[model samples]
Target: GGLSNLLFKCALPEHILSVGDEPRQVLLRVYGAILQVSASGAGIPPDWQPPPRPAAPEQLQGSGLCRHLPPGPGLAAAPRLLRPQGVDSLVLESVMFAILAERALGPRLYGVFPQGRLEQYIPSRRLRTEDLRDPDISKEIAVKMSRFHGMVMPFNKEPKWLFGTMEWYLKQILELTFPEEEQLKKFNHLKTYNLQEEMKSLRELLESTPSPVVFCHNDVQEGNILLLAGHEASSSDKLMLIDFEYSSYNYRGFDIGNHFCEWVYNYTHDSWPFFKASAENYPSRQQQLHFIRHYLSEDSGRRGDTTHEEQARIEEEMLTEINRFALASHFFWGLWSILQAKISTIKFGYL
Candidate 1:
């Protein structure tokens, strides 16, 4: 049998899999699983017949509930999981975010399995760094992020401090064992700069900043934003945010700042274990204003209709806040990279 037939036989349940059926396209591979996604109207082979639809699960069978429950919107074509190994803890966080953000911001959750999850396969392309450089696209993203931050999701946990989390990760990196030569090379710079002192300073600066605490995507690199098809230049829903593994309630400015900082790193090359960071490529003051203005105005529902003086004041405050929190974003990712350097096998620069 072919690869598709084999995947169908091994991954799908007996009631759902039919002999000789082709599997869907592999949408993504991450954290030891492949996301096999199918479109709703894809044509099946002429000789193939689908298996009978199974009865609703037992939980949905009680109290005439099945009758009132609306039919799922083509969830049968939802993405399936192909995990040859156990799920990672970070993958569980992805599952948690998908479940919590369903119909709110992120992708819809179709089902969860011991090995992985089934999700609604959004037809989209991962955004490029240049796409984010477009003024209209940047504004739309700001507005969408503002709307997301404003929502009161059902999560009940206390807001975690962004700086505190960075410190925790840094501590973990300190505790890990490393080869003598590797330790000498990586630790020499830290010893010279007194990393503990720098971290303390960062903590103080972020704590002193007056940013509002809101639910944040935490990681907002270009790769996480998907550009959907058939959108006009100004459409708000053109870009969708994905990958919520590091999402949490934190200072709102941190999200915006992290995204801005992400512009510096280019991960497209085949160069082994290294990424290019050009300081000159960072967004300029005008660009930052362009993004921050949209974020602030949208959150306020003004959308640039404010008086010139009012707009200026808002821009000034936002610029100050974002600049300060950008430091926190840098520190957070810097520590995360250190930890990834020790454990991750992916050929990306972690230092």
Candidate 2:
């Protein structure tokens, strides 16, 4: 059957189909190409094909009660679908994180497939960069993040991608041979800042202020945060985090720091300078304190009744840690961009 027929069988509404008009084709074009390249690299036969689509859609079992309905006719059921991306290990990690996160605090994972997995399609507005600065929204994000960190799931395998640490990413970047002098010159500009010494300083600070390890949504940028439509501003379930591909156990400060760093870059443009960062965009000291308060309040059970001074002291310490971890975020993504500049076909200023 054709893609349209498949959507009809799933009972998806016509209006829903009109939006994201070419979702399936886009998914196939992007992930399909990546899968083919991955298969070729793995020595798979040239004639190999992607896993066949299931005869029937599978409904998600035991998904928690829906807090708010979609704008159109409420979906009768959320079906699991194939995700045509990544190798076996990567696929497994993605499924594992999705399942664990769903059960805990993130998006609900419906089912797993060989190449792709199924997820509950949430109809919500993707947060704008300005929204991150909103105190109410930022507090909701902090609560959700704190809840995610508190989850204790069992997964023994190490993650294939680790954005919290700088070593692996830096190694990958250093190994790449830039094809043009311009690229080399951009890299040299990065080197002039004495990033190696900065890396050492970051490591020392992290070691000095050791944070408790927890499951982290390593990529908590504005794009990943969704504000549910038709929900009151004060609703606790108003915000939901998506895309767990980079989710893993890491330092708590790194997750918070990475999110703050994300606020500086705008990735909406489709040009050479796809993203621009500015120091003026970083969260101010007062804003950081407000965010940290919400974060620490989630674990109030352990703190017992505390004086205002005690709470203020706690916030001060967390702010210091978050400030230090901000450096690690810069180092991690700086190396990632350098490596992507070499391998990625998509046009963007990775340097």
Candidate 3:
């Protein structure tokens, strides 16, 4: 049962007691906490003075979370709320950015406010200068983030499990593949998922290799990367990843592939903003080619165990894998939206 009207008293040198009512009944820990009953049925009187919440981030005026709680339930809703509704999400994201900083002495990610929606306030230090641009720094950050993905820490209230079984996998595959045409089929929700050798191939894949599932940030878009102060000043100003609301447990290759797709699409189809024209910050295409060639070589450490047969098939079939997985992701998201719509009786588009 959620605490109906629980009052938690803060028991620190600086007395702060938290009052929260949630959908679950459980004790929580803050710097120091206390539990009490608020004066029953009492509401704040009009004559009583209470502090006003911040109206704007600028108005927050750089006063840190330690001094004030950030305004709105935006961040609280962020780790789960998805699909845009006007400027609401974008605006909230802007506010969140204002509050977050990095730690120098630890794992290095620090939001200005670590209590309430963020987490317990830990002893945090300032952001350092060397942890951003260096290849070693990038790798370190990527690795740490990978661990979090592997943990697949559910942001929503529910504990998550990757799609239940091979049957589920087969169903999704069948839903995407085409029976009437060898080429990709336009999806029809009412139509049955085409069943063919594709289903067999998928079933074989699931049975043949049982990979350890890890959390993947499926939408690893450019906007999700939070870059610190530029490196020109010799500040490492590393990339801190945000927007994990779209995480799933799946093959890590998809995570890399998703990133690759965005990078490739942006560079090839969009513009030079990604590269500084001289390939300074993020490499130009040629530099990217060199990096992939030299850095991804067998001795370069990018290798994961791939069977010679799988490698051979990969050249023949890797593209198929990408399309298949992407199609699956689409179905997953679409089905997810439909379910959410049905369950909540809320309007949501399916596609």
The lDDT leader among the candidates is 2
RMSD vs true structure, all candidates: 12.9, 9.0, 15.1
- Candidate 3's residue-wise lDDT over 195-227, tens digit each? 345445654653444233455666554544544
Q: Give candidate 3's error at residue 111 in angstroms.
A: 9.7
lDDT of 3 at 120: 29
> In what order do the candidates fall by lDDT, top score first?
2, 1, 3
The sequence of per-residue lDDT tens digits that candidate 2 reaches over residues 242-262 is 666557778888899999998
Off by over 4 Å in 3: 1-116, 119-161, 165-215, 229-238, 245-249, 258-324, 343-348
Candidate 1 per-residue lDDT, tens place, 1-351, comes to: 011111110123335543473432212211221222111212222223223233323222222111112112211111122222123433555655665556557766645554344444566667776777888888988888887787665553455646546655655555555454764487556556766788899878877878887878877877678787677756767878876656767888888888888888766545855457767868899999988877877777534367889889878887888888888888777766665454443445665
Backbone collisions counted per model: 0, 1, 8
TM-score per model over all chains: 0.71, 0.73, 0.37
Higher TM-score: candidate 1 or 2? 2
Cα error of candidate 2 at position 34, Å: 6.0
